[model samples]
Target: MQKPHSINLSFLAFIGVLYSFQSILGAITFQGMPAVFRQSGIPPIQIGFIYLLMLPWIFKFIWAAPLETWRQKKGRRTNWLFLVVNSVAIVMLLLLTLTTPDVGLYFIFILLAIIAILSATVDTALDGFAIKESNALDKNWVNVMQIGGGYLGSIVGGSLFLLLVGRYNWKFAVYAMVVLLLMMLCYVLFQQQSVKELGQKSAKQSLQKTFASKQVQYGIFIVVIAQLGLRLAQGMTMPFFIDYGITLTQLGVIGSIGGATASLIAVFLTGLWVTKKGPGFVLISLLAVQISMYFAFYYFSEKAELTLLQASFLLLSNSACVAASFVALYNLLMRLTSPEQAGVDFSLLQGVDTAIALIAGVISGALVQYLGYQSYFLLCALASFSALVALPLLNKSSSPLKVVI
Candidate 1:
C-alpha cells in the first residue's frame, strides 16, 4: 500500500465532509423521517417498513466488487462520487423540497431509497480511498473522520432537520439540506484527487479468495460479536425512556445533546487511543467500558422513577462508549483490508455489521417485551462480555496490532 508522505489536513477535511454528507441521508432515512411519519399519523407497521429502504446499505457489498473493478482506472472513484452526488442525491433532495410529507409520502420513500443507494455506493468508494491513502499508523485517524463526521451529520439531519420541520416546514428543511449538499459537492469538485493505484496482480484476486483468508473470517466474527450487544441495548432505549415517562421533547433534547455530541468526542478520543495503544488494546478496553455501561443501564431500568439527569447520563455515556468502540472496531477492520480490494473487503464487513445491528434491533424489541428492560439489559451485558472472551481468538492473527489479549 502506498502511504502519503505526511498527514494531510486537507485530505482529512475532505474525508470528514464526504462522510458527513453521506451520513446526512442516512440520518434522514433512519432517524428523522420515522419520527415525522409517526407524528403525521402514519401507522406503526407502515413506518416499520421504512427500514427496508436501508436494504441498499446491507446489500451494497454485492455491487462493491464491480465498483472496485471500475476504480482500477485513475480518478474513476472521484468521478463516480461527483456523478452520484449530482445526479442522484442532489436531484432527490431537490425533488423532496417540492413536496410535503402528507401528500408525497410514497414519493418521498422512493426518493430516499434512491438516495440510500447513492450513499452506499459513495461509502464503498470513499472507504477504499481512505484505506489506500493512509498507512497503518494513521488509519485510526481516518476512522475518526469517518465516524466523527457521521455523528455531526446525524445531529444535523436527525435533530436540526426535525427542529426545522417543527418550526417552519418540510420543504424549507429539505431545501436547507440541498444547499448543504451543494456546498459539499463544490468542495469535492475543487479538491484534487491523490489516490495511488494498486498492483493489478493483487487486484485480480477473486472475491471468494479474499473472504477465504483466516484473517477475514476472524474480522467478520469480531464485527458481529462486537456490535450485537450495542445494537440490542440501543434499540430499546427510546421505548425504555417512554415507558419510564420521558416526554418526546425531552427525548429529543437528550438525544441531541447526549447522543451525537458525546459520540463525536468519543470518536476523536478513541482514534488517538487506537493510534497509540493499537486497536486490539482499544477494543478490549472499550468493551469493558461498554459492559459497565450496560450494567448501569440495568440499574437505571430498575429505578422506581427515572430523572432526566439520570437518563441523560446513561444515554450520553453509553453513546460515547458505542462511538469509541466503533472507532476501534473499524480500525481493526481497516488493518485487515487488502490494498488491492479495500472497497470489497471493507464493504462486506460493514454489510455484516449492519445486518447484525438490524437483526439485533428486531430481537431487542421482542426480548424487552418478554423480559423487561432490566433483564434485557443484563442479557446485553452478557452478550458484550462474550465478545471479550472472543477477543483472544481475533487477536491471534497477522494484523499489525499487538495480540494484547
Candidate 2:
C-alpha cells in the first residue's frame, strides 16, 4: 500500500493565514465601523450602507459554481485561488492609497462594495482549499486549523485590530489588511501544489456532479437543514446582544475573547472525543447547548455584573457549539469529497449555508425592528424548532473510515 500523506506543515500554515484573512476582512470593515465612521455630519444610515455592502458574500456562490467547474492545465483548484488572492492584494493596496473620509456616502459605499466583492471571492477560494486539502486522518485537525484561524482572526482583528483602528487612522487599517492578504498569498505560492492534487473542477459540471452523489446530496440536506434552524435562531438573538443595554465594545469582548477562547479549547478537546464515537451525538449535543444559550440572550441586563456573567455563559455555549458543529461539518465534508471535485463540493456546501443565512439575516433584522428585542428572541426560540426538524434527517450511517479511540 502507498504511504498516507500528512497535510504538509507549510500547507497547513497557509490554511491558517487564509482563514485568518477571511475573519479579519469582513470584521475590520463591519465591527470597527462605528469607531471610524463619523455620524457627525453623515447620517447613521450611511454607515448602515457600509454594512449592506457585505451582501455580495450572500451571493458569492454564484461565482463559486464556476470555480468548481473550471479546470486549469493541472486538475488542482489552486489556480483559481491564486488569482483570487492576487486580486485581493491589488485591491487592498488600491483601497489604502485612496483616501475616502471626505468622499460622499455613495462613493464610500461603492468602494466598500468593491472590497466586499473581492474579499468574498477570496473567501470562496480559501474554503474550497480547506475542503480539498483535508484527508480522513487529518479531517478533524483540518477543522481545528480552520476554526483556530477564525478565532485568531476575530480576536486579532475584532478586538486587537478594532483597538488599533480606534487609536490610528484609516490608512493604518488599510495597511493592516494589505499585510495580512499578502502573507496569505505568499503561503499559497509556497505550497507548490499542482491543480489535480487540489481538485479544481469546472463549475459547469460541479452542481450536476454534486447531485449525482447520493451521499453528497444527503449530507447537504442534513447540513443545510441544521444550518437553517441554527442560523435563523441565532440571527434573531444576536442583533440584540449589543443593542439592548449591552454596549458594543463589551459585547465585542464577550464575542471575541470569551467566544474565541472557549471555541479554541472545545475544538481541540472535541477532536479527541470525535475519535471515540462518530460526530452524530456530538453535533446534536452542541445544537441543544446553543439553543439553551440563545434563551439567555433574552435575560441579559445592562448591569455590568449580570451582563458579564450572562455574556460569559452565552459565549461559552456559543463557542462550544461552534466547535462541535464545525468539527462534524469538516469531518463529513472531508469524508464525502472526491479529490476531483473537492473545491466544488465544499463551495456548494458553503453556498447552501450562505443562502440559509441570508434569508435568516434579512428576516431577523426586519423582525427585530418591527417587533422589538424580546419578541425577536421569541421568534428565535420558535425558529430553533427546526433543530428537531433536522434530527431525523441526520441519522448516522456508519463510515468505514479508520479512526483511533
* Best model per TM-score: 1
**Candidate 2, residues 111-193: lDDT per residue as tens digits?**
66677777777776676666665642276677777767766675556545544444565567567766766766666666645
Backbone clash tally (model 2): 12
In terms of lDDT, which candidate is strongest?
A: 1
Q: Taking the tens digit of each residue's C-alpha lDDT, what string does model 1 give over 83-170? A: 5555578888788876777778989988988888888888887887777766532566777888888777877787667666666678
Error of 2 at 68 (Å): 4.1
- What's the TM-score of every candidate structure? 0.85, 0.77
C-alpha positional error of residue 367 in candidate 2 after TM-score superposition, expressed in Å: 1.7
Candidate 2 ranges with C-alpha deviation above 4 Å: 5-7, 29-72, 75-80, 83-90, 93-105, 166-174, 184-205, 233-239, 245-255, 301-306, 393-405
Supply the global lDDT for candidate 2. 0.58
Looking at model 1, residue 245 earns an lDDT score of: 65
Model 1, stretches more than 4 Å misplaced?
A: 1-5, 38-48, 97-107, 166-169, 192-202, 239-250, 302-306, 368-372, 393-405
TM-score of 2: 0.77
In model 1, how large is the Cα lDDT of residue 106? Answer: 89
Q: What are the root-mean-square deviations of the candidates from the true structure over C-alphas?
A: 3.5, 4.8
